[model samples]
Target chain A: MLLSVEDFGIEFHDHDSPERVVEGVSFTLDKGEILGIVGESGSGKSMTALAIAGLLPRKKLKKEGRILFEGEDVLTMERHKLRGLQGDEICMIFQEPMTALNPTMKIGLQVEEALRIHHTEMNDAQRKERAIKWLKNVELDDPERVYESYPHQLSGGMRQRVMIAAAMVGNPQLLIADEATTALDVTVQAQIIKLLQKINKESQVAILFISHDLSLIRQISHNVLVMQNGHLVEKGAVDDIFEHPQQEYTRKLISAIPRVEL
Target chain B: MKKWLKKHKNFNFIAGAIITGVLLLTVLIGIFATPYDTTQMNVADKFAKPSFAHWMGCDNYGRDILSRVMEGMGNTFLIAVLTVLIGTVFGVIIGALCGYFGGLLDDILMRINDVLFSFPSILLALVIISLLGTGRLNVTLALGIAFIPSFARIVRSEVKKQCSLDYVKSAALMGAGHMRIIFVHILPNIMPVLLSSVMIGFNNAVLAEAGLSYLGIGVQPPAASLGRMLSEAQSFLFTAPWYAIFPGLVIVLTVLGFALLAEGTTEEE
Candidate 1:
């Protein structure tokens, strides 16, 4: 197993009360498999993704159980060790393409930043070459032009592609895409999903895809995990979850996917 | 630049730059040469009018008014620069730390900042100056300390705004250290906001230095300051009006220059 959570839980401390967000949730992801986590806004899907990457806010936060990445306990890992693990071993892309890259920095530098941080042994010229190669890998037309461009100079789809290239450049073992394509239009969203699948196939990198759109989840993910009100309601192959959802919450989620009959 | 000037009133930009520029040039030029000795007291020329020899006339002490004003401009400009430097460097670091990593440090530092913020900056500056004793250097340090909380507060809020943005978060996930994230990743994103804040800080610094000097505890004996000249000119208001007018005009122009420059930048945004 590449990643595993053994009865993990998260609670946020309010002034008078401690609210449980994820309760005894446990799952495992194998290398090179695309796992889908489908849930509504407050279903704890995104929180799980954050916890896996150790990105959750520490203030007013409490955690229990174990989040093991490759047999090491992530919750108790040394900060420097955790730092080394992230961006190199595991990477996460966020929702808003418009704001994911720094507006002031050129896209090329932003991508090279990842390489510069992790691959300190690699000199400037090699880092630049690697960044452009990944930019091209994302199939952006004229990667050379896109490399020098600022985040605002590109469209939403192009920016998303750039962000993906930045994330993928380090050759991370796993990619946690947290609502990554949610902000794009439907057509662009489809394109992004296809691109992600292509990247997954070409690179064989494990992916933890989090989103509310069941159809999009079905398109790219091999396995599906349905969450409801901080609980894992169902887990199975993507086809099984969609064609025959066992739990009431899972069925409702499946039924909610907008479709038009001829 | 032409398009921008046409789009906005831009009167403040032009007026502020010219006034500040002239004062700056005068002070800079004074480093090389001044018409007369600022400290030389000639009893015979005490009541001299604005002549070719002394363009701004002579003070009661017979010191050349033009020379004194030039040196005073230098003092005012130095204090302004020093105050801003102290405020921004320390303030930005403290604010970035507080905002990016909130918890005990945030509570402790921000509480201290809030206490400082509660007082009027001038009053706080006076209190600091009194504690540290008087002089141009002390006044600059005092005003710099007084300005710290506001700079910290502005940076704190702006840093908080960018803290949650994905670029910052992704940078963190990419194993970028806290210092790297704060200065490199987040700082540039908030540049426009910080720039406006620094400009406003400059205006306040210039005004505070002049005001403190006017109160008589600033830029002590022999060393001239615009405010010190104004204080001296108080007695010779009618007798040698130019003595008071020249320094007073410089102070007003410096203050207005900074204020308008700050206003213009924010307006552009």
Candidate 2:
């Protein structure tokens, strides 16, 4: 497994009360495969991603799990080692591209920042050059203009493309895309997914794509993990789960998708 | 850029311009002019009327009011800049720590802030100046302490908000440390707000200086300050009104400059 999560659980503690937000989940992703964790809001799909990355709220959230990234227990990894791995080894793309980006920052410089931090060997001109290259790869029109423009200047789809370029530019082995395309319109969403699909195929990067849209996940993901109220109710090959859902909740969720009647 | 400026349609552009223009004029005029030395107390020219020789007239001490106002503007600006630096540096650190770490640290820092907040800012400054004694440095220190809670509160809130953002979580999952996430991702995001707050704080710093000087706890009389001028002019208002007029205008313009800059940069984040 490229990434193996064993018996992971997360509990968020409020000053007033403490409760388990996510409990007892296990999954694995092989090299270059896409794993989709699908559920409604509060189902803990995002939380699961956060736990594997070891980015849970340090003080408020209690974690118990073994997350193995290439046979290394990431849960127990030293902070310095973890820091080196983030962006360089595993990166994330947030949902709302505009809010996710530093508004005042130029798009190209923002994209290059990940490389600058993780790959300190690269100088300013080299980073800028690579950023422009990736900008074009994302099929952004006028890469130079986009590079100089701030986050607010870019359209939502364009901003998400910039984010995708930034997240992928670091050449991370694993990419966690949390609702990465949900903020865009349906057409823009399809374009972003296409871009992501292209990147995953070309780079052979493993992706954990978290989204509420089942059909969208069905299109991109190799395996689907159906989650309900923080529990992994079902998991199987994307084709298998879609064809013959073993769990009632999974079956019900799949049935809820609007169908066209002749 | 002109179209963008026009689109704002807010008091920000025009008011900001007038404010900056006035302050710039003060700085420029100060650099090149003198019917009498700002500090020179010539008993011969004492209390002279407005003329080409002394446009703003003379004070009771025979110092040229225009020269005094010019020197005062420079001193006032120096104090505001220094105090703002001290306050903002201290505030950002405290706020970042309290907001990021939370728990007992946040509680302790916030409680301290609450205590400071309760003490009317000017009164707190007065008390500190009274205790530390008076001077430019002391006034700056007092004013800085008085203004810190505002910045700290704003920074703390910004930190808390940024901390919850998905990118911050994403950065963390990737293995970025708390320091890296805080400084690199979070700090840069919150900076626009911080910049606006700093501009506002600068305005407050000038106002605080004037208040302190007027109350006799700021820059001593040999120094020219708008507030000191106002206080001195109170006694001579029946005779020479220009003593108060020029310095008052300077203070108004100074505050307006910072206020305009703050407004222009407010939406930057």
Candidate 3:
């Protein structure tokens, strides 16, 4: 197994109450396979992703569980060790591309920065070369021009592509995409999905695709894990879950996909 | 580079040019030009009116007023620059750390800032000067300390907001150390605001220095400062008005240049 979680639980400490978010959640992601985590906004899908990456807000959170990445316990690691594991071993793509990037920073410099930080051995020339290469890997046209442009100057789709390029430049083993395509228009969404699919195929990197849209997840994911109120409702192969869901919530979620006339 | 330059406004460029020219002129005058040694006194030339020999006229001590004002401009720039440097660096470090790290650290640092803020800056500066004893160094320390709260408050809020940004979170995920996230990702992004803040703070530094001098605790006599010049000119305002006028004009020009530059930078942002 590439990544595995066992008996993981997260809770928020309020003044008078401790609200549990994810409880006893367990799953595994294998190499080159896309694990689709399907849930609504508050279903704890995003929180789980944050826990895997150690990006969850710590002050209010009471996290208890074992998050094993490549056989090491992530939750138990020191801050420095956890940081070392985050971007190099596991990378994440956020939902909103517009806000994901710093507006003042040049798109190319942002991508290059990821490389410079994680892979310190690489020189500036190598980082720039890798940035340009990754930009084109996402099929962005005029990568040179786009690199020089600031985040605000780019369109939503282009910014998302730039984000993807930044995430992929580290060549992380596990890619966690959190509502990655939710902000784009339908057509642009399709294009970004296609781009992600291409990257998955070319790189053979394990991906954890989190989103609410079951149909969109079905398009790219090999296995599906449905979450509801911090609980894992169902887990099976993508086709198996679609055809033979064992839970009511899973069936209802799958059925809720809007039907379109041809 | 040319395209970016082309986008620059006429007023910003003009104002920046004027400020740069004045700073350079002051520096040059300090380094080289002076008809008479600023400290040398000629009793015979006392109360001499504006003429080819002594363009501005003589002070009460028969020292050259024109040379004194030029020297004062240089000293003013030095004090302002030093004070701002100390305030901005120390303040940014304290504020960024407090804002980035919340809980007890944030509460403690911010409460201290609040206490500092409660006292008016000038009054606090006065209190500090009185304690440290009157001198150029004391005045600079008082003014720099007085300005620290403003810098701290501005940087604290900027850091708090920036720490929540996706890029910062992303950097954290990218194995960036906390220092890296604070200095690299967050600091660079907030630099434009910080730059503007520093410029405005420098303007306040200049004004505060002047005010302290006007109150008689600033740069002492024998050392040329626009404020000291003005303080000495108060007695002869009716007759040798040029003593006040020359230094007063230099102060206005210096202040105007900085004000215009600051306004332009704020607009650009």
Query: Considering every candidate listed, which one attains the maximal DockQ?
Result: 1
lDDT of 1 by residue, A1-262 (tens): 9999999889999557999999889999999999999999999999999999988876688998899999998888989999999899999999999888998899999998878999999998899899999999898999989998999899999999998999999999899999998999999999989989999999999999999988899999999999988988999999998898899988887778888989
Arrange candidates by DockQ, descending: 1, 3, 2
The candidates' interface RMSDs, in order, read: 0.8, 2.4, 1.3
What is the per-residue lDDT of model 2 for residues B1-269, given as tens digits with 9 covering 90 to 100? 68966777667757787777777677677768744678888788778888988888899988888888887887788888998998899999999988888999899889999999999889999989889999998998898899899999999999999877766665565455678777777898888789888988888889989998998889997878889889989998888888888888888878877787677666442
Query: How far out, in Å, is residue A194 in model 3?
Result: 1.4
Tens-digit lDDT string for candidate 3 (A88-160) = 7899999888778887778888888767777889988898899999999999999999989999888999999
Worst 10 residues of 3 chain B by lDDT: B8-17
Task: Give per-residue lDDT, candidate 1, residue A137.
Answer: 89
Give residue A101's lDDT in candidate 2 (0 to 100).
77
In order, the candidates keep a fraction of the true contacts of 0.84, 0.56, 0.75
Best by TM-score: 1
For each candidate, how many residue pairs have backbone atoms clashing (under 3 Å)?
0, 1, 0
Evaluation by DockQ, superior candidate among 1 and 3 = 1
Residues B1-269 of candidate 3: C-alpha lDDT, one tens digit per residue = 57766787558646765876876586677768877899988899887888898888988888888888778877788889888988898889988898898789889988998999999888999999999999988888888898888898898899999877788887788788888778777887778888888887887888888878888898987888888888889999998899899888877777777777777877776
Residue A204 local lDDT, model 2: 95
DockQ-best of 2 and 3: 3
Candidate 1, residue B71: how far the Cα is off, in Å: 0.7
Model 3 segments more than 4 A misplaced? B1-9
| TM-score (chain A only) for the predictions, listed in order | 0.98, 0.97, 0.97
